[model samples]
Target: MGCCVSLFSRKPRLEKDHWQHTQNRRSSSAKGASALSGGGGSSGFTEFTLAELKAATNNFSSDNIVSESGEKAPNVVYEGRLQNRRWIAVKKFTKMAWPDPKQFAEEANEVGKLRHKRLANLIGYCCDGDERLLVAEFMPNETLAKHLFHWENQTPEWAMRLRVAFYIAEALDYCSNEGRPLYHDLNAYRVLFDENGDPRLSCFGLMKNSRDGKSYSTNLAYTPPEYLRNGRVTPESVAFSFGTVLLDLLSGKHIPPSHALDMIRGKNILLLMDSHLEGNFLIEEATVVLGLASQCLQYEPRERPKTKDLVSTLAPLQNKPDVPSHVMLGIPKQEETPPTPQHPLSPMGDACSRMDLTAIHQILVMTHYKDDEGTNELSFQEWTQQMRDMLDARKRGDLAFRDKDFKSAIDCYSQFIDVGTMISPTVHARRSLCYLMCDQPDAALRDAMQAQCVYPDWSTAFYMQAVALAKLDMHKDAADMLNEATVLEEKKQRGGKGP
Candidate 1:
């Protein structure tokens, strides 16, 4: 059975403006636009600015690195929270990987058109100057490699393994039907489990990493024979890679295809099974999967089974449809921790400390820009056309924020900030809360930091930071920030001077 909920249940309906190139850059080709505009509307694609990404990932800090190769990998993957507060996997490619920015954008936009529950969908991309990055939905529950080979608690159950095999087959078949059949480096590492523990095929494999078409990144022994000959990947090459994955699931070890084929021929099926399983798996089912793997491993490309055939063969093997994947995989279901009680304070402080974003929004709307009055003290003579325009943008942002139109508020606030004519801690804090309401804690945190920079002793700035940090799951930091905000508020009430 499929996972309990659709992965796209919260998919963002991004604005058309977000897909446009920045004013400084030349327009992309019509083909790129056409491909991005597919699927009726811009429901699944976004073009992120490099600054937004840097803020999300804390400037690509090594602590956020998630790739198996870590920082040593030419292409590094970092876990980040978008301004919308959505967790994402950002794959930053090497500068030389895609020299032609247009080509990279077009390829990414094409891949972004595809949306499947069994696949970790590509949500956005960045092509700023010489930088190339692809953003995908993050899978919280580790990769198949970790679960299969280096599992800490227990090896994956046979039924779950069968489910993983079937789910990934469906993912590949879906991609094939959608006109994307060539998957690069299809391996256990590319198979990731979502929050529900259901396996998803990584969309990163659909795009060639290098312009030279160097597809496989793993050891040469695991690569398809044809790719060795021509340095190219066809639809059949993907099938060959799938065979290796099946071998991985069956044996729980990275066995060479040639060695696996020899063992199969010798009827050493029992010997090939993962000893960790302790013969718990169904022999009949294992035999059927083994047969399919051998067919996929056939030396001749034409001899390998199609993706559809793999799906059909694995469909009957599913035995546990009612049970959730997490239960079978021994992964704990994600549960929200209860809030810790604290001594009460003023309504705004209490709301901020508790992360009651709606309550905070109400307070912000009521207060309006009154806190900003003294900060932006512009003389009549100094009020230039540019200054008026910037103030007008802030006014527009405030109106939208009051109306609960967060996306419009963000856009207006961004315009106001870009003008750089005046500094308003209130504006930054309000925009920061708007970002929090929109589920983008990272952007909220950055805005909160900007507010702190503008008004170091402001309690609202620290409170907003606390809320953002709490949203990002940094509870310890959030508590510390909240405490600091409380101290700042108490000092302000007592008529104490700024620190």
Candidate 2:
């Protein structure tokens, strides 16, 4: 790992020229995506009338409300189901005093166009006569905070928690590219999980702070130092909020950034990790996350790592393979007794469901295929030598992957794959990720697709394909691939056939 960059060091902000280039690229992407997908709504958004929203939310019944309560709350969220039976979340700004409805809708439409796998994409908006509302894809799995702090059921596994960090960071990084827009009041609550059990940043985060009001929901301790001192938020302020979220993930509890910084400086982050993760977590990975979190919590806004840096850092820490949302979130599956099935539950099933790629690798490394008999046909010496060779190559790959030496890791994994000692989905997945890091999207996509073909039930393969596709700017296709991955994941997690 590289030495931590000092947070106090000021970095140049994205200049106007950069913004112009970004906008041009965005326009090209939209055109390309629409042309390639043959769909007009590549943005995956819509516009709604107030009456339609009212109908979807049962006339804004109290039972449908999802956020804080108040007769005239400044902003409130409601859970709604559109006429098409698609579940959605509606954010109504009661106090937002936009003078022109056309201007408000235009601004809302601009936000809607900003889409990414990690964002809860804006589905539509309603700006009718004094009513201003934005509708988003409803996340049934609820907020990250609910699982982290208020879980009445099983807590999320270490892998799921780590994935959440990656998802949010990716979302923010995409936002930065779109226009370094201010993501006000970013916290665990703003991060929600989709039906596929993937984490998504709420679209509301992109709303300009002026519209959301100056008051923050969290304590001053958690607010960025700039916001605390100047009562103003900049792009860096959003980064600071991201840092607080990182702290929350590391500690498994909310700790003020100042106090968290004290722990980080003292190298006592191990003491802050969630007690539940102690036995199940990897020390090395946790240390990396803690270090990154500490950097994010730096006092000077200039010192903080930007969303792009966070995305780069987190993309690797998301080590585990993709697990179905239902299993990761601990959502109960519907009971069903299966008749005779072709693909019975294998040892790999449970490990893969939990995203325990390490365990899967160990199992694969240990596995020795027999010649159609339940017997070790090889001589003891020959078997031992073969095992040693396989283990050595796998170890090399693992080390290279951990060190972020994607080229070396790809070489090592390729050697193992060529030998064909044992069938392992994780090797394919890992190599695919390495290919992505090496900017070989075609190879990455190929490997990911091959992995999926080899293990149709594995969600990780689909996720890899999604990443590769996104890199290629095939956003619509990537989304479709992700949905497929999520479906297969959900089925496998529920102990059903991959449909």
Candidate 3:
């Protein structure tokens, strides 16, 4: 037997056979549990539950939709936070996009195995019933398209643009080396900025957006010539798409490949450069990139350079290696702000009055919704299915709150509120803080108002409102609310009912 055969057995078992066996085992186990455990190189990959995902995205609310095309896209990507406080981008596929759940899970697992600093790595996936979703590390700053094409404040600097090209090329090369050469719709949108504003290739592009194999969603002008004829994606096709992205970086607009080639042919390189750069870019670097773009956009796929070649050609052009991407790109550096000093008050009152989110979060975690214990007052006769569900949701929210899982707490508390059973000001107050901790001051404000509606004289309600207002930058309103809360607390302590 050749190297392909197993040495221990006369019966031949190829490498593909071994892989298939492992995949079968994984698939079988996945069917038994709500999620598949990580195996092989995919140790970090998780098979998330539908309930967990629904809770993360607030039941796939449109408000959480983060896709470039928004709700109009067949597959919508939502920004979400897991119970562990990790932020994720959830791509929810349309119904029956992957009819075979096994295929979906396998594809997800294969893609999840790839992790690199250059990639927005796949974290997990959910294949519950007819719903199919892929979760990846959230890229906070936005896509290259947003910065390049629809820039509001300032366009990306030359150094930042070069960094994007070099980084994405390295990403493509890394993926190709790892045996995942084909990337669907490799465009500017597929390049996203992480917290540090570094460009990372979205792993979502590795898997076909749907099982139907309709890969390219961009305009036909930007698509590779081979794909138009053969209706399939190949490694060369991805290279051609990368060429279009390079043109986007150079021209600062979507220029068709054919049109851009004519400009390159006519020695209009200067005109092709982004006018926003104002001749700041080095001539030698621009010419090198233009030459590469011309070669990549060649009509014959065989004439185009490989992913590694692209990386080699672009690597030396990077001049700002020491500078952080956020600094080069003009994005504010993400840093923790020191808490401001505040006057001393009751523990809970002081935390909220100071608008110290960390202190308030700690208070909520310690309180464990004790104040809401007797507030609902559900009797045995009134304990129907809806009431049980409402209470169960509140119980779940309390547990999550105690664990400091604010996202889950928000979801469970929202469920309880939606049930519209017996109201509890404490539940609203707790959820208000959950929203605050989650950085949703508007939602926190709404919940605080709801708490005030339930119990107008509740000091916690006023305090939460104050905190939310302070977060929203309405400092005057926040100070007034804080003073009102102090008065209410004093009245309640002095054996007088608060107004």
Clashes of each: 5, 1, 0
Q: Model 1 over residues 280-388: C-alpha lDDT tens digits? A: 9999999999999999999999999999999999999999999999999999976534223233576777997778999999998887665554444445665678767
**Each model's lDDT:** 0.77, 0.65, 0.76
Q: Could you give candidate 2's per-residue lDDT for residues 1-499 as a string of tens digits?
A: 1111121111121122333233333333223333222212222334565766788789999899885322344577999875444567888876455656666666676676565667887756766777888888677777888888888878888888888888788888878887745788898889987766678899976764335357456767788877878777788888889888888887779889878878878888678888877568888888888888877777777888888888888788776675665687788543322111124334544443333445544443343121112212334444556656765786788788777777998888787766654444566777877786677876777677555434444566666666676776545446544544444445556774421
**If ranked by TM-score, best first, what sequence of candidates would result?**
3, 1, 2
Q: Stretches of candidate 1 above 4 Å error?
A: 1-43, 69-72, 335-499
Which 10 successive residues of model 2 have the least lDDT summed? 1-10
What C-alpha lDDT does candidate 2 achieve relative to the native structure? 0.65
Best model number under TM-score:
3
Q: List the residue pairs that clash in candidate 3.
A: none
For all predicted structures, in order, the TM-scores are 0.61, 0.59, 0.61
